[model samples]
Target chain A: MFQDFKSDPFMFCIVIGVILFVIAQSLFFLIRAVKRAKALGISNEKIKNTISSSAVFSIAPAISIAVTVLVLSVALGYVLPWIRLSVIGAISYEVPAAENAIEAAGLSSGIGADITDPKIFTAVAWVMSLGCILPLILIPLILKKIQKKVTGAVNKNAKWADIMAAAAFIGLICAFLGRGIAGTGELATNDAGEKINVTIGDGAGILSLAAIVSSILFMLALTLLNKKLQWKWLEAFSMPVAMILSMAVVVLISHFAPGLAAIEWRY
Target chain B: MMKKNRSYIDSVHFYGRIWCLLALCVMLLVPTLMSLHLKAWPDLGIVGKAFAATAVLFYPTAVVEVIAYAPLLGAGGTYLSFLTGNIVNLKLPCALNAMENVKVKANSEEGEVISTISIAASAIVTTLIIAVFVLIFAFNPKFTALMQSDTLAPAFKQVTYSIFGAIAATYFVKHWKLAIFPLAMVSLLLVFFGSIPIGILIFVGVIISLLGAQAMYKLKWV
Candidate 1:
């Protein structure tokens, strides 16, 4: 019954319907943006570069997300995880949300238990859906107001406006950089949701640090080569290209040397 | 002369509102319709408890994310990204890369158009990739195990590092003066506080950077 309920055709139909709607939304915006770009006299080259680069960059990240789909599918089935991950659900939230929903409802002995009962399944789905529903509702409600405040306040000084913009991006990047440098940071949960010590300068920490540095170096090399060799195409796609190469390095290190994103030494 | 149509920004809002609202309904309908089809109604009491558990942690970050990302994403990009998810890891970076490619500044007309275009392109590719994964998993369970294996999980796990490292290379150098203070402070704080949510740290980092920028502006160093 658990397997039958999970693989139900009705669920697949619903997920497909949601996916189609999302794709339609994307297309709606894509076409409008392209038309507007041309209308604004943006060159075809620029538009093409944006699309090609974005699409290419998306592949690695998309696959990473697909992996989350596989993980979540085990418990929730393919369709629920599919809809969740593809539309508004993220790894940091979805796993815990699903687990909590199950435990809270007293539906299973432990999480990842085959949820045979439809009531339990529905309850889990409801929590995951409703919990992350804020952004979807808030954006439409308040985004324009937020934009108006920024525009009215900051745009008066164009230099300041650019500074604020760069500052925002910098802040975001720095937080992620700190985390990358920190790895899972002292502690993280295992599959059983048990807290465990995560050693830095070794284990997961070393790998994360290594990946970041290697990726930055790759980007630097790509940027230099693009400038020196005048590889115009590489200029646009350097980041994604560099990221793919870095992921390869990770696979290689894990496969061969094991751990360490860079060379290590003992004094 | 062709009559200038509704300003692109205005029209974007007009359409963005409609589409986002439609998406909200569709998103809500996922659980709503599923239960109806199965004829299985969950206990409302159990549902409330489950919702509260995740909501308490996620809601604050949701507010931070919408505020943090909306400015950078522009109007159309905001609507599309909120629906499509993975904004930080994929869409935002894609948009930034696109604008960087064309030498456009955020908060400009070119930036708005570029962000929307790249985010849209990214959203399509991501959805298509996930759909393909679903297809493969449905047909072949064995292959899914290989994908979920320990050997390759490192590469997937390290994705965030690689992406941010690549991005940091661009911005850290470009905005060194404005970035240094926040980067140093946040990295230092994170080393000590390890459990601090990245979302909250991002909000704090933004505040620090803004303050740093303000000081630089006052001194005319920027």
Candidate 2:
């Protein structure tokens, strides 16, 4: 009678309910920000562009997250992964958290295994939910204090704040790039939270380098075109266009020019 | 067009706390509702054991991320962003792009509003896409195989690099002076150590870049 409890109807209700809550919260903030943007005299045109371009920018990345849902759905069923990927979940940790929980429950959850037992379901869901909940708690308590300091800095030294903002993103971009190229380190955990060693250049071997290079070229081209040609409207679309085009280029390379699209270290 | 005090930023925190707290409740309820609906309260001791293991690995990562990202994302963005997740790959870039397009400082009133708008848009779009994907996968088993097709796998595999590369282009090209120090330092570290945790790397990344920015500012080079 309980053959497929993992995808049970009741489970879908809970997942959908939580997702709806997220959408509602997002809408509330969106509307509030839009109204505030206007009072601040940020042209309606600017707000509109930000919304539209941000929506466009999100598509390729969101599709990739959907792919994560597909991957995790195999072990725990669809609803749990859907919820996990949607909220407070990072791709790096969700799978490992489930693996750890299942290992504790004495069941193997190696992606394709038949881990649909009810006990396994409860265990995976609980761990995936609780494991990433700290941010939910800590963000509320500390974000305000953190934001205060940032605002204080900006108000105190306007020039320095601008430099700090620029520095913050540059550092993040380079760090992620280096991490991607240098390979995830020994401290990086595997599916069950065990530390694993990775060769320094192992992450560099990714044929996905095609996508990175393509994105760089595409973005630089767009930026240059915008500046030289004064295609002011084109500036907002650059990030999304570059990302989507880069993904498309890699897809073609992998299929037609297969060797050029070597798939390595997807994480 | 200026105010005596930062009331708007304060209101952002005001409304932000309510939204974030409410979201947390719903998050906790996902598991709570599941156990009730299934009539299967997981054995407390086992749940505890597994949680302790997972928590040890993730809890520190979460703390580090919050500290690193809060300043960049601002009050409203941070509140909404941490709840929605996928900060670096998605939200951070979206907010940055929006601010760049509009030409505002990240900590300014206009930047805060713009950041909130873009992040909220990004979050909604992401949730909606995943929801649609879930429905399709549930209705049609073949859809999974189609999505997993070899033709599309490469794109999925390269999504992060695609995102970071695109985001990096914006900052590095414009701020080459400031970019040089941190990017070089990261490269040196990756080559020499090759094994730092990403959470720690992020902390390192933000610190060095700030230092780089400070040094350049003092030198009047930027």
Candidate 3:
């Protein structure tokens, strides 16, 4: 008993194109590192530097691109105002009669035409701004901490904290997948084509199914790709493709479900 | 050694000649289709105004990077700005690589290696701070959702997963470094010149980028 959100196809394609370009470019840097390594005579010390540099260099651009695009979109919305229409206008005929009647009555204001309230925009903007910026700053700090712990100044056994953190991340990922799936299930119809009702009760099964499928696919692809191909291109395309496809599916389901973002707007 | 660098120039020429036309075509078609289907086409005046507005907002960092922080002098700051700009909104690779080589002078008796690491770390920190500022105050998912509709969400999702792809691709390719300047320029052109047809501009830019790159290579710029 669930309905899925409809995903926007146009966005999916746009994201795909972006992903391709980023990956393609990153691969270029990797190639450069290799050539540079070769040029330097590929000694043990040089090779190590080359490897680390390549890895770190790639990380910089990928992170930069992602964060930039996300933040820019939000910022532009703020600095520049935009209008979004929610309710569709109703159809009408007898325009001449209506115009004449309205003229006689001197009542010409159109009903049901409402500009979005400034308050809601301000509130949403505030929340969005916070969401975009906070994590960007914090994530790197957290990553640095993790790196420090993993490669300790003093060598020690792997800490329980790291293990717990990994587990938590996995759990969060599962939950996200489950939510997507559960939301999608609500949009599904029965044999009679009646819309299924989604509530807390039926959310578990769909979520579990989606999570299991996603995990299995992720693991299988990782293993297979690692076995067969060099790491760079595989890393560049495979994981992102999976993430985008799943996200697109979930979003599409939501879009088609009229009840999903069914927030009532008052102007 | 010089010959090897020169070969890079030739490769850019070869690649750029073919790809520029394709990019140009795509650039032309995609935006036009988007406008028609979405009924959201902006007239020339509107587009120009919007473009100008965006440029103004970016000008501060641009000026700092391009002028105050000259590539040869204020390399670190310039690079930091370039990286921050990429992470914030636009993906122009303008002076990022050149900034990477900025020398970090440690007051202490630290060696060259230590100094280099310090510089890199400082750059990273600066980049993060810029990104945080952008994200915390400038980002707007709601409007993005409006402009992109629901599709933007999945693209984001794709991006999350694609990190691994970036990592992997960066790890394995040979001579990947040569690709950076061209890639960065292409990304810049695509993001800014939205009016240009992607296929055609790509075709032209790729050609131009390659040719330009080859010329640089021949001149031993690499």
lDDT of 3 at B178: 39
Please tell me the interface RMSD, in Å, for model 2.
2.2
Per-residue alpha-carbon lDDT of model 1 for A1-267, expressed as tens digits? 224786688888898898899889989889988998998899999899999999999999999998888767667778888899989988778887998788887744434556778898889888888887788789878898988877876658878888888888888888887777642443445676676755423233656777788899999899889989999988989999989988888878877876443332210
Chain A fold similarity by TM-score, each prediction: 0.89, 0.87, 0.33
Among all windows of 10 consecutive residues in model 2 chain A, the one with the lowest summed lDDT is A198-207
Candidate 3 chain A: worst 10 consecutive residues by lDDT? A82-91
Q: What number of clashing residue pairs does each candidate have, in the order they appear?
A: 1, 0, 78
What's the distance in Å from true for residue B79, model 3? 13
Candidate 1, residues B52-141, lDDT tens digits: the string is: 888888898899888888888988889889888888888999899888999986677788999999999999999999899778877887
- How high is the DockQ of candidate 2? 0.64
In angstroms, what RMSD does candidate 2 have relative to the true structure?
A: 3.5
- The per-residue C-alpha lDDT of model 3 at residue A8 equals 32
Each prediction's DockQ? 0.67, 0.64, 0.04
- Candidate no. 1 TM-score: 0.93
For every model shown, what is its TM-score relative to the native structure? 0.93, 0.92, 0.29
| Off by more than 4 A, model 3 | A1-7, A42-48, A51-267, B1-33, B36-39, B56-222
Best by DockQ: 1
